[model samples]
Target: MKREEFLKRGLGSLGLFAVIPALTACLKDEVNASTNTTTSTVTSDPTTTPSSCSVTNSETEGPFPTKSPADYVIQNIVSDRKGTPLTVKIYIRNVNDSCAIIKDAIVDIWHCDAAGLYSEYGGTGMQSVNLTSVHFLRGRQSTDANGMAAWTSIYPGWYSGRAPHIHVHVYNSAGKSLLVTQIAFPEDVSKTVYAQGVYASHGQADTSNAKDNVFGDGVTNEMSTVTGNTTDGYVLTHTIFVKG
Candidate 1:
C-alpha cells in the first residue's frame, strides 16, 4: 500500500512541473502583448495633451483681404487665376486634444497668382486697376469627416519682396475664428516650382521664408509639406490646431 501511494505522489509532482512551464510562458506572452499595445497607442490617445498646444501661428492678413462675409464660403478658391494645378489641404485639430481631427471646421484660404497679383487687390502688378470685384485664388470650405478642407489652386508667383505663401483662416461652427496663419513652402521645392510654368517669368521668390517679414518668427508650424512636382502639380498640406 505504501509503495503504491509513493508512485501516485511522484506522478502528480511530474504533472505540476510540466504545467508550470506552459503557464509561465502563457503569462509572459500576455504581458508582452499588453506592453506592445500600450506603446503603439501612446501617440494616438486623445487624452494625452501636449505640454503646450501647437496652435497655428497668427499672421498678418496682408493688404488685400476679401471683405466677403462668413457665409460666402466656397470650396474652389482658385477661380480664374490659373497655373500649375496645386491643391491646398488644411487639416484642423483641437489644441487641447492629442491633435485629434476636428470635423466641421471652417477654413478660408487666399493667395496671389503666378503673376504676383491678387484678384481683389489693385496695384502695379495686378491685372486690373482697382479690381475689387475679382475673386481669384480665394475661397472657403468646411472641414470634412477627416477634418480636412481642400482647394484647387495654382502655384503662386513671387514678387520682389514677399515669399510665396498661402494665407489661411480657421473658424469654428459658431463663426468664432480659431486661428489666422500663413503656410510656407520649403526653399528647394519653392525654387524648383518657380523655375518653370508661369512662375518662371518672375523667377524664384527673392524673399525666402527666413527673410519674409511674416514667416520669419514662426515658420516651423506654418510651413507646408508638399508632394509631387510642377509638371504634375503639387499637393500642399498643413495641419492647424486651434483653441479647444
Candidate 2:
C-alpha cells in the first residue's frame, strides 16, 4: 500500500512540473500582447491635428481682392514683390461629404508684400500709393487630384488695423463661389520673420489676431501652419473645407 501511494505521489509531481511551463508561457504571451497594445497607442498620437472635416469659417474678401483673379492663373505669383520667400499650399476639401479632396476647384490667393503694401489697390481713402495697374502677389490655380493648389510667393507683411494674413477665395468647377476666407499667421513666427532683412524696415504688425476685425471672432479654423525661417524662407499650408 505504501509503495503504491508513493508511485501515485510521484506521478502527480511530474504532472505539476509539466503544467507549470505551459502556464508560464501563457502569462508571457499575455504580457507581450499588453506591451504591443501600449506601443500602438503611443505611435498613433501625432503632434499635428488631424483634419476635422468641418467647414472653414467664411471671411471678408478684404479691400484688396484681386480685380480679375481669373486672368492670373499661374503657379508662381511672386512677380516683382520682394521679401522672405514663401510657398503657399492650399488644400480644398468637400465638407458635404467626408472632407474628401475636391479636384478642379479654383483657388485664388493674394497678400501684401514685405512693406505692407498690396499690388493692385492703393492710392485712395484706403491706401495712399497708386499701384492700380501693377499686379503682384496675386494668382489663381486649380486644385489637382489631391485637392492642392500651390504658389511661390513671399511672406506677407502687416498693415495698420490688421494682422498678417492671406486672403483666399474658393470656387466650384462651375464658377460658383464656395467660400471666402483668410489665413492667420502664428504671432511668434510673424515676430521672427518681421525682425529679419526686408521685413525689418516695416517693423511688426500693429494689430493682433485677437483684435483684428475678421480674426477677432476666432482663428481656430483659419490659422495656417508656417514652417522654416526668414533665411530659407517659409511654407504656409492650410486646409479649407466647403460645402461643395
Candidate 3:
C-alpha cells in the first residue's frame, strides 16, 4: 500500500480522536519576540525563496493548531521501501536555553514525496503526488505531558542533493517558531544514496556532518538515530527539546 494510505488506516484503527483533546491542552499561547528591532516584510521570488525549514530564531505563522499530514497514522511502527516493518520512538525536549521547558510545545513535520520531490518546491515534475490541497507527508503532533512525542513513519527516500532525512518545525503555544531543523540518517545509509549518483556534484551529495553548511550549526549526534535494522527495514529515532 502507499505510505499515505497506510497512515490513514493506522490512525483510524488507533482511535486517535480519543487523544486529541489531551494533546491540544499542551500547546502554549502565542508570544511576540521581545528582541525584534525591525519590522520590514518583503516578498521574494519563488525560485529565490529561502528554505522555510529552520531552527533559528525566526518569526513564522501561528494560532497553534493540530495539523496532521496525509499518511501519518501507522501504529508505533513504520515500513521501509523494502516492506519491512520498523518500530520508531522519538523523544522531544526543549532545546532553547532562553525559554523554560516547553511543557506543551507542538512539533510539525513534513518531507519530500516518495520520489524524492517536495510539493511546494518547483523542481520535481511529479505534480500528481500532491496528497492534499496544501501538501502531503506533512503533519503536526503535540508534546506529551513529559515533553516527548513519537510517531511511526517510513524511512524517506533519498532525493538528489540531500541525504535521507526528516524535516521538523518546533513552536510554542503562541505559534512562534522555536527551531527549524532536519534530522539526518547515519553515514552508511547516506552513502548508499550518494553512491547511486542520485544527486549532482553541485548539490554536494558527499558532504558529511562536519562539512554540511546547515548542520554546521550547534546540533549534536545525540539528536539523531543510527541503528535498528530490523526485519522490516531500519528504525530511526530522534529527539528534540523546546525551551519556553
| Candidate 3 accuracy as lDDT | 0.41
lDDT of each: 0.65, 0.73, 0.41
Q: Which ten residues in a row have the lowest lDDT in candidate 3?
A: 21-30
Q: Please report, as a residue range, the 10-residue window in candidate 2 with the lowest summed lDDT.
A: 20-29
Model 1 CA deviation exceeding 4 Å by range: 1-53, 69-72, 123-129
Put down candidate 1 lDDT per residue, 1-244, tens digits, no spaces.
2322322222223321111111111001111111111111112222333354578788888777655624235555555554666777878889767677777776778888777887766845534566677776776667888888887777677766788888888877555678878888777777776666656667778897788899877586777877666556677777777885
User: What's the number of clashes in each of the models?
Assistant: 0, 0, 21
Largest TM-score belongs to which candidate?
2
Question: Model 1 Cα displacement at 142 (Å)?
Answer: 0.5
Pairs that clash in candidate 1: none
lDDT of 2 by residue, 16-99 (tens): 111111111100111111111101011111123345668889999998888766556667777766677788888888878777
TM-score of each: 0.74, 0.79, 0.51
Q: After superposition, how far is residue 171 of candidate 2 from its true place, in Å?
A: 0.5
